[model samples]
Target: MSVINRVLRDLDQRQQQQSKGSYTPAAMAPQPLHWTWMIGIAVGTAVVIVILLNLYWWLTIDTDPALQVVEAPVTNQPTVIAATAEESADQAVEEVERGTDAESASKPALQRGPVKPRELVQVPPSPTESRTSELEEAEATTEPVVSEIPTETLATVAPEPEAEVEATDTPSTFAVERVQLSPNELAETNLQKARSALRRGEREQGQELLEKALTVMPEHVAVRSELAAYWYGRGFATRAVAILQQGLDRVPQQSQWQLLLGRILERMGRIEDAYIALQSVDSSSAEYIDLLEVRGNAANQLGYFSEAAQDFLALASLKSEGRWWLAAAVAFEDAGEPAAALRAYRQAAFARDLGVDARRYAEDRLQALGGS
Candidate 1:
């Protein structure tokens, strides 16, 4: 009874001591977030978005070899000239009258079939398109057939005054006027007439018309070129050279004239002259690539393999074609530059963007160059 009383008294004293003080709650552990942490989270999120966008672009866009980066069409085409006032008027009339091109004039305006020209009434029908109509008319009419006249008798027949009057009454196609038209107008008219003549297959007449145009506008480079081209296309290389030479004589240092002359000479088989002429041509010409190719050909013809190789390489830069690359490689081989030739051959072999024949030729060259 003495031990139990002692233990009970100690427990009651401890309970009474804790009841006298205020009760306190447990404290939580500290967790801190600063500005730097927020910034790092934002930056990480932005980086992830950027990476995803780049991946999308990579999958969607594919650049092809034949793809071109087009710019605004502002390059000066020196060879082309604007249409004249007369030509513009003609075009406007043609448009306003038919709401179409010149060919519309051949169609009937108020009939179901093609228009029959009214002038054919007083004039005999041409042998070309009206032959069937003429034959049908002769069969329909009961006109008596005259006796067959001998060729000699027809040739020896006296000239009729009516025929002479008709010949004299025929209107001239063009009446040249000194002051009625400006120099440009004169040139343009002649140029148009020349083109029409060419289209009509009157080669000699076309040449004459172009020459007349050149005479009217002596300083006109385009007219000069047209005349030169007219001769060149007809296989008159010497005549083309002469025309270009005359132009050059009037004004030396004309890069176009020189370039064209060089081309003509190259065609004429005057290799040395062509090389010399081409060497003097300015690099700023509109057809710089053609000049490079022609000069390369000239150099090749002149046995200047090193120069030819360089020129062909420059041309290859202008046109990324297998044929140009192959030409450069061949020129390099001729110039004893095996290393450059090998590189070019490889490029040409892999240049599938070029023409079929060019790729085939390049592959053949690659095989010949001891490459797999």
Candidate 2:
């Protein structure tokens, strides 16, 4: 049994030796490739792949070189807009000042007032009227005899006053009583007497006499004319003009009556009618020369220099002397026509030295016309 046991153990030891000899050093150590190492390498490789993909996406997609992006300034939009708008406002203000100076040079200077010129017309006295003296004689004669005085006889009696009687005449001496009065003339005398009484403060007598005179000759021209003068003296110019105009129509050629009518017309502010009446008188007639002067002066005052010139010229022709020539010259100057004015001034200067005033006036006008 012992011997069998030793042999079996030796067999077992031999079997063990055989197993050790078969095992190499590489087999005795761990295996070179393990499951855990393999898993760690796989995870590291996946992490590397993910990092490379992220780097590629960042480089290729996030940056673009072709697009240009501009950032706005820090200022507000309205402020930037205002800065741009300021440059356009300065160009509109320079065009308005040049149009006002060209309009003032085209008009004439002002005249202070209307001017008067000189010239006039003169009417002569008629040769046909009955003489004042003849009327007086007829008034004294009976009606039948007065009627029997021939028209031819009446026409032959000169109406003008006698030169001798005129030289001796005075207001008192020439009173209506000196020559016998017609009924009409007597009524005029009474009216004049009434005016004188009124002027002397004898009012009741004046009124009574005027009433009696009017009763005797209701429409007598002399009586009406005297009453008209009385009313005029009392400041009733309108009534005076009415009466004098009627008197003038009845005796159109009586220069004395016409003179009174002109005066009444002037007093009534009927300037045109006054001028016409004044213009009707003969400048050569001694009775109306004073009236001609009045008419010329009135025409001058009213700016009717042409009418004044006419009056002055008529007066100058009648007198044909120094002062009258000067007056006519002045009238000619005022009426325009420097040539005519020059001729008139030469005539005046030739008549008498007009001093510096007339000479200078003529010289200035002549210079204006290129005549001197």
Candidate 3:
């Protein structure tokens, strides 16, 4: 057989064999179906579907319900809080008003009508009271009165009018007496007279008399004070201060000497020392009242206003007349106490019959201070 016929014959034999028993068509073949693999595939597909369903639920489900519980609205909160706060405030205000009303109601009532006095009624004593009074009288009357005989007193006695007694005036023991000075005091008096002469510009005679008086009593405080005054009149403050200080040392308790020293120190511009000397005087001493006045004036000039005010207040308490009130007003004003100054000025104006001026000044100051 030729090669082509042989090949065709083998292909027909294979087809015949294929058409015999145990042969299957392509669309209806008894292929070896892998049950395990199909089952595994179905299970995998089911797992994937289930996973996708779970993922969709997880991704799309609403979680607002869970959050809503934590963030819920507070119902009726504002209205309730406002009502409670308003009620508390009203209660507090009502309490305050009640307190004020109670205070106002408790004030003393004024008289609305004329007052009638109570009538006095006298009652007679009871029997027990009369008996007790009689018992007390009986116990008190221990002495008996004696009676004169009527026959002996038969003669009539003429009655005489009583004489009037006249009061006599007696002289007061405190009347000023002419006191004779001792030799030393007289000499010191002469020295003061001479110093006065010098102060009056009689220099030659004053120097002569002072020299004579100094020869007599060299250690007299009056003489020394007068000499210091003379030096002060001559404008020798240092010498005046030294002499006055010596006199003060001799008579430490003498207000006149201290006043002189203080004056000299003040004139010399020794303010602190002057104040010290002036403050040594006792305010209650009648002897130093004049000296305290001088000190107050000096303090005023020195601008020691608080000190001046204190001194003026003391003088005011003494009821001093003339310039005391004026001094007090100036001192108070300089001390930065405008209210007290105004009061002092008012008192001064009233005292000095300058009421209109004082009132105007005080009113102006008060207005400047936004009114009292």
- Ten contiguous residues minimizing lDDT sum, candidate 1: 61-70
lDDT of 1 by residue, 33-63 (tens): 8999999999999999998886664333211
lDDT by residue for model 2 (1-372), tens: 999999999999999999998977665666589889999999999999998887775444322111112344565322212211123222111111111121123322221222222111111213343254334445554345345778899899866679767866745554465666677877877888887998899876886787678677766655665666767777878777776676667666566667777777776677777777776675455567868877887797687877787777777776665455566656766777566666655555555445667666655655665656
Q: Which residue pairs overlap in candidate 1's backbone?
A: none
- In model 3, which runs have C-alpha deviations exceeding 4 angstroms? 1-205, 208-221, 284-287, 301-303, 319-323, 333-339, 355-359, 366-372
Give each model's whole-structure lDDT: 0.74, 0.62, 0.65
TM-score of each: 0.44, 0.41, 0.41
lDDT of 2 at 307: 76
Q: Against the correct fold, how does model 1 do in TM-score?
A: 0.44
RMSD of 1: 47.5
Ten-residue region with minimum lDDT total, candidate 3: 61-70
- Per-candidate clash tally: 0, 10, 0
lDDT of 3: 0.65
